[model samples]
Target: MQMLIIGGSGEMGQWFATFFKNEGYDVWISGRRGRSDVAEKLGVRFTSTPEEIIPECDVVIVSVPIDITPEIIRQTAPIMKPGSLLMDLTSIKKNPVDAMIGSAPEGVELLGTHPMFGPSIPSLQGQTFILTPVENRCEKWFPIMRELLERHGAHIEIITPQEHDHIVSIVQGLTHFAYITIGATLKELDFDVQGSRRFMSPVYEIMLDFVGRILGQNPWLYAQIQMQNPEIPNVHRSFIEQCERLSKLVVENNADNFCTVMKDASVHFGDTGAALHRSDKLINAKVAEFEELLQSIGKEKGLYHIYSGKTHVGIVEKVMARSVDILESGKLVNLKIENVRLLNSDELNAWKNDNLAAKTRDISTYIPENADPDTLCHILGKISEGISCKVHDTYISPDGRRSATFRIDIRQDIDINKIQDDIERLLEGIGCILR
Candidate 1:
């Protein structure tokens, strides 16, 4: 059968077009802009004139914005063939379903559907498709639609239009309200969310991620879902009432009442233990995924501060099959990748500067003398003023000659040979030879 989707430039509409095309139907999409490139990518036909295409299509799905869907249904419903099917993809079903029933031709089938996902989802596996069949004059069309969705692993929930709206009010309305409120509160408080992450527990991090996810989507879509559903106001009122009751308990400092409230909620939810178990598995999976990302960062060639049970700073010289080779304080150290709890670039630049300073002081000289420690310290002190230097202990040779050694540390950007020559000239004047 030929299928046409209005507003097919939209993400959800494009999804439907592609899905129906994959099911061996001749799929075409009509939009205001006539996005031929999008139609080509989705392997469907594109048309700027939908009125010309509506009457020819066996299945017409109105997939426009929620607010515009009713009008689109009214315009196209009368033009559809007598035995053809009509449907809409609207989050709130009652209004669009009513419009289709009132406007569609006498014999055209009407089905209102809401696919509970976005376009980024790869397939319909384990996803839900809520169907509210308003009129099924073509009785076989409903079964065909159900079979097509089921073949692709979609779980179909057939309900009345009123029932769908009522359930979504709680499911989408209450949940999104809580998320949006939390996001706004954080913004109002000017919370330093990234700076305070060091103090966040896993649960807090997950909740923050969820808030981010919600705010990242198109605002109009969320607004439509919250505003278009007639049942949302009651849901919001109930949510606020519960919050007020919790606040009163806190104000009264009534621990017993709070416990009773918690018990009642737990009972209402039911299967608490199973829910906890499932959530624990999800949390563990997230933690493992985070660790794997850290391990991948550790395998990169750069300076990293590794923290397993202890902290060590080094440059990641090489990544081996079973371990990593790090150059730490002029020595190569190997560490197993799995043993690292955190490997970060926080102290990398500081460690690199220190390493460069150490490399500049690579030359060490010893001078043979029989001088007192005080005199040697004084001579070294004078030379130290010109450059960075540290004096070593004196050692007596077999010939009873005493020798002292010192090292010079300089900046990497300076002329190392010129500084060494200048220091040697001063040392020779003090009767100390470079050994």
Candidate 2:
């Protein structure tokens, strides 16, 4: 199957292109003002525009910015082949779905999809995918697309285009507006966000993370999301009014009335206890990882960069509030705590297998008279993905017990001293003793 994604050079577009390619489709991408370099890196074909290639594609996805999604849909849908699918991955569904219906010919299936997560997400697992499928419009393709997405761990939600917009107005619109407003207000106040972290509690730290996450992304995309959605103005107004009301309450220092307002709002907000529990879990998780880093000082630890997908395996010499200093090959590399995942032992070894040089060692161990030597070797090989074990020799020890020697080939950069105890444990599991 051939799938063409418009705006393929963009973040979400590139993400989908890679996704479809992995699903065995010959993916093609059309970037409006983007270079083909991005498509090349994504291992997908690149086109200058959607017009020339839309008819040839089995699936045409319009993933352009929200402002141009309608126009892009109109231009590409007319040329799409009958029995093929035409879809939009825009945030706002109503306008683009309308355009697809108006411009697409009778047999061309139409679907309006909004992926609630961003490109930064590692996988489809636990991600929400909103589908705005029109009645009698996408009967043939809707089930196929929904099933495919769900099979890969996407949480699919079926809703009308108008309903999607209405919900997203609060979901994306209100939250984004509030966070961006906080960021802008901080700028206006000349407040140092980094310096404020020194005195921040867990809740404050988490809130600052959300604000920074928004402020770091593309401003143009955020602007289009806020400006193009007609329903967002009402949400924004409601949020601002609520903020002003809270401010006025604080200004008047009316303790009884303020408590009444808070109690009413708490009653309206469902599951506050569950929300608090989840937030506590998040805070505890952060503290646990930080504690691990602290314990890893003067030890070989591995940290995987979330965005770059690079693994840094080195001695951890220093740990700060929001950063860590890794002594990698006599060079100190500072990494942000938020931007990296601390690798477990298995993960660290797996990374080393792909990057480090191979080394072989012959290990001899005394086995129990009744224990199977072959089974012990099998267990040893299963210890790590980076190592292979083969039974090399068997002989009698000086004490007259049966003994087996294995040739262990390690392709990972593992410290032999640390792995030696692990090997001894494996041998002892089956009543075997290490030589």
Candidate 3:
């Protein structure tokens, strides 16, 4: 089988090309510049033009940004053969679906797919690929596509184009729009995140992870999603209005009104369901399990929480196993364990006095020097998105160990479990061990 990916030099294109190549398919990557250097590096073929690639491939995947998708579809539509599968990997669906439908040959199999995951370079192991079936002729290729995705460890779901966009408006469009707006606003406020890691909470750190991803993603792609989806503007406006109303209630000291508002909002979230659906429930579950193990290790060590006054800061002391090496250096150090919890001062004092092998000394606390940056970023990104952690900055110790700090205003109670996984993921990103 042969696959041709447009926008091949771009991150998502590179990922798709890599995915298919790994499965032993003959993959050709095409981009505007047609440099082909990346393809050579990956031992794949490269073409500069879609016109050159479409006629030669069985499957043509367009992995370009959403804004450019429609034009590209119009341009490539002319070359697609009657039986070839024409697929778009853009994040938004409706516009591209309309464009392809309006432009494609009668017998061409046009498919609209949004691979739920971004450029994280993860295996399909438990990832989901959403397919929006437009043309009936495309149904024949659904089996082949499903088989390919399943073989590579991906789960597949089929939905109508309208349903796909409706769901994505909430799942992708609104979420990205909110994070990008927050990240931009925060950046403008000149928050010094790097300087605050020592006193930061795990939850705030996770929000930063989410903010950073949308901030780093292609702005045009993100903007296109926010703009292309007709339902998004109203949803975004409603959220803003709700915020305004809440602020007004607080300013006016309207306790009864605020209580009513909060209660009404709670009803909307339901008793057990979160507003957002799990993107990769399987991978997230695995991450949660790993995090639980880390917490367990901390608990075993009797690591108790440290506080500044009445506020919980972090864990300072833990039950030391005789076999576990406890080093006392002033420079930053990276430590890992299976489980931990925030300890009260009394608990921390007990560990410090009894179990600690030495006086509490700081070797700057962070991840080990050997951890991978990409992994660290991924973990941090997840935390930022999954837990609403507002990461302000990242820091590196003199020894080159890394750490990040996030800030959050706790006006109301929040779930620590929702935030903890991202926190641990961020630590793992920097090769730091979490206990």
Candidate of highest lDDT = 2
Model 1 clash number: 0
Q: Which stretches of candidate 3 lie over 4 Å from their true place?
A: 273-435
Each candidate: what lDDT? Answer: 0.78, 0.88, 0.67
lDDT for model 2, please.
0.88
Global fold similarity of model 3 (TM-score): 0.63
Number of the candidate with higher lDDT, 1 or 2:
2
TM-score of each: 0.67, 0.87, 0.63
What TM-score does candidate 1 get on C-alpha atoms? 0.67
Candidate order by lDDT, highest to lowest? 2, 1, 3
CA shift at 371, candidate 2, in angstroms? 10
| Model 3 lDDT, full chain set | 0.67
Task: Provide the lowest-lDDT 10-residue window in model 3.
Answer: 356-365
Local accuracy of candidate 2 as per-residue lDDT tens digits, 318-416: 999989999998999999988898999988877787778878888888888987878888988888677788899999877799999988877746666
Candidate with better lDDT, 2 vs 3: 2
